[model samples]
Target chain A: MKKYKILANEIIEFIIEKNLKRGYKLPKVNEFQQTFGYGKSTVLQALTLLDQQGIIYKVQGSGVFVRRNPGDLKEYVALTENLGFYSNNQNVKTRVLKLEELRLPPKWAVEKGLPASPCYSVKRIRIKEDGPFVIEHSYYSQQSVPYLSREIVEGSIFSYIRQALGKDIRFSEKYMHVVKLTDEQAEFLQLEENDPALEIKEVFSLSDGQIFDVSRLVYNYKNSKFFSQSSDEILS
Target chain B: MKKYKILANEIIEFIIEKNLKRGYKLPKVNEFQQTFGYGKSTVLQALTLLDQQGIIYKVQGSGVFVRRNPGDLKEYVALTENLGFYSNNQNVKTRVLKLEELRLPPKWAVEKGLPASPCYSVKRIRIKEDGPFVIEHSYYSQQSVPYLSREIVEGSIFSYIRQALGKDIRFSEKYMHVVKLTDEQAEFLQLEENDPALEIKEVFSLSDGQIFDVSRLVYNYKNSKFFSQSSDEILS
Candidate 1:
């Protein structure tokens, strides 16, 4: 991640950690610079990025203030971010419905750039405060991932990939469409059959441009608002 | 618009005008340079931008090939773009449901940054080949737009704002969420009253960062797939 993005994420953590509310005044730019030990320009860039994301707003003469609380922001899925659900919803828990290793990858997985060799097929539901809002079916290339454990699936996979494996996802090809909920999906999401659900398909590649994971995420009909910028800059 | 974005839009138009198909071979870099009279770097940048948008793909040794037919792309709305619907679906037609000049704008308009003085309230349905798929309720700032006619509302408002008024939309703050269709919206979109509909709300600004337009668009549940890049780069 870039320095500005790192600083911006740190500031979000700070806001949430301090239980900041809307209109709550933040530290001065110089205070941020002194605390974070970043250059003045980098700190300003981080603030500007946050302002653009509607997280914090700057008044002409006044200092920066929170526009919305982080808890309120948990419902919005950042379209460009691959940080996983746990990053946004700290209270989110995972239920692994299916996890298996396969020698012959499925055709859909192969089509999404998964090697036709050993791979893992996983199905999981992300349980938030309300209920299970997201059902994620993922296929990971074993050659790239090497292994998978139930314990790891219960936590943030992206964070594990970045911190433990030292591999970072650089970019993704994503498509978002609406689909009527199936009986099975409805049962899982606690929605009526044929309810409209937002389905997002993503193919993730590592920084070295190697395809590693392909995931199809189906969100509950309600609480499925996603956010992305018209600019190509990554939100985080 | 930037030179590369302009070229990219032109390339998309050329692909559509020529009725290009998936796997179709596009002109070489030198051919584009000669035809468009742009520097090689600018031309390459445009192609790279398109490649990132999944419009075209390049093989190591082989030349560029169309990844998908432009006609097949109409269903995906570019989230980062403020170009309006007509740019994507040229065959789309508009039916004016309501067009009026208002002294005191609605609360929604004011909340979205509309001036309280005078503005234009526009309600229209966009009819595509399939059926009426989008209901647009827009509020335009009269101070910035000056004037609007039913004829302009029947066509592309954004294009008029750019070409006729000499003002271009620079950026927008957009939110996408799902809503249960109301009786009126369902009748206009030909969906059930409680069917899921995708709603997009955007506040558009001019090049000088002045807000000029605020629009709430409701799309038919069947054809509301929008596209956007996670990267900060604008996908033309």
Candidate 2:
């Protein structure tokens, strides 16, 4: 076999030429190392890199195997960077079921550090291609956006708040967890009873650290994926 | 009634005093305005400010309500900062289940841009206050960490790699989603079959962008939470 540096590429070509699909088990490492006349470390280095790229996965006690078709790599990359990628992929659409302004209660008022009177809330559903992906519940401080309406939410709410209102948004805090679908949420998302949904809760803040919006996005994971970035220090 | 500012604070104090909880509906805007003797807009402004702080949530067709337990404020704040407050708060204990070096297959080698040989795999279980919280499966490039051993992984694998090996880990790409537990994972996590779990798949990279590690973190959502930060521009 070629030297260690080129061995990884050669193996990839073999998989492509052989048409090995996802979940296809590979030959044992000892055999490959002997055939390639390379140290075990060299071979492992190559495999580890591939795994990081999302091309393969390892099942403990089982063995390393090829990953299933990852769909489109470009689309996946785009989805991570731009929400517009949803529309570009032609597989997801935003449907504004309802949008309105309403007051929040005293308890919530205190938690958000508002004057503790009333607040405004916006609700919408996101469709995946032709199917449903998530139901979104968003609450915004009217003081942050004085005049909100259904027409403004029809498109992208983020765009409207920034461009139209001239609100300089800065940073936000986000939380993700899993939750059993409420009966109402299940009905809205067409999920079965007891099915778990991924919940993304976010608090939007301004440059001055004034938080003005909190949103709960619940997604049916049977047809979706979420991605993020982290520092490697956490692993160490 | 006091002016709008103090009225807002009073509203907040009232919520706290009454010990309101999440999902507990609040009074309507008109009711609040009349009771507080303030302009409708002033009351709305106070509610709006509170919403921005993530203290309250609003539901259309319903009313404003607390979103999370008031007692969880400190934990919530730390979580938003990615401080692992929940794990720390619960004082979770980690146990090394298995750590070993194995040969990687050709497919994995190709995906990671490695030479298609052997790699190292580390597996462990993390418990929260003695109960299982998560199971972690990590794979490392043999070349990057050739001397990895079971003993080294016993403590914190992340700490060892950075301190001992002096590997310069920089950034990582992570994919988060939900998955139904398999029979084995369920048994390890001591949960029922098809129980939902939070799944995080990550790829670690060096400063130069070389792939160094791939890890999958599976957590019992009943006992854990995931938090992150983003720009408000994305939300607005």
- Which of the numbered candidates is closest to the native, going by highest DockQ? 1
Q: Model 1 residue B180 lDDT?
A: 79
Error of 1 at B124 (Å): 0.7
lDDT of 2 by residue, B109-213 (tens): 778644224667778887766478889888877767777776777666666767798765655556667888899998989888788887877766544445667
Tens digits of per-residue lDDT for model 1, B1-236: 68988898899889888889755889999999999889899999999878656577665577887755667667677775556666677788899999998786467555755644488889999988889878999888887898999999998888888889987566566678877788988888988887887788876766544567878888886866766544322211
Which residue pairs in candidate 1 have backbone atoms (N, alpha carbon, C) closer than 3 angstroms, thus clashing? A230-B80, A231-B232, A232-B231, A232-B232, A232-B233, A233-B231, A233-B232, A233-B233, B77-B227
Q: Is the docking of candidate 1 incorrect, acceptable, medium or high quality?
A: acceptable
lDDT of 2 by residue, A1-236 (tens): 33543766656666776777755887667876887666798778766645543355555577777653344232341222223334335555677876666676768777764422345677888776647877888877777777777777666777777789876666555667788888988888888867888887766654444567777888886866665544222211
| A143: Cα error in model 2, Å | 0.9
lDDT, candidate 1, at B135: 91
**Model 1's DockQ?**
0.30
| Model 1 misplaced stretches (Cα beyond 4 Å) | A1-72, A105-116, A232-236, B1-72, B105-117, B232-236
* Model 1 lDDT tens row, A24-141: 8899999999998899999999997786555776665777887656666576877755565565677888899998887763775556555445888889999888888899998888
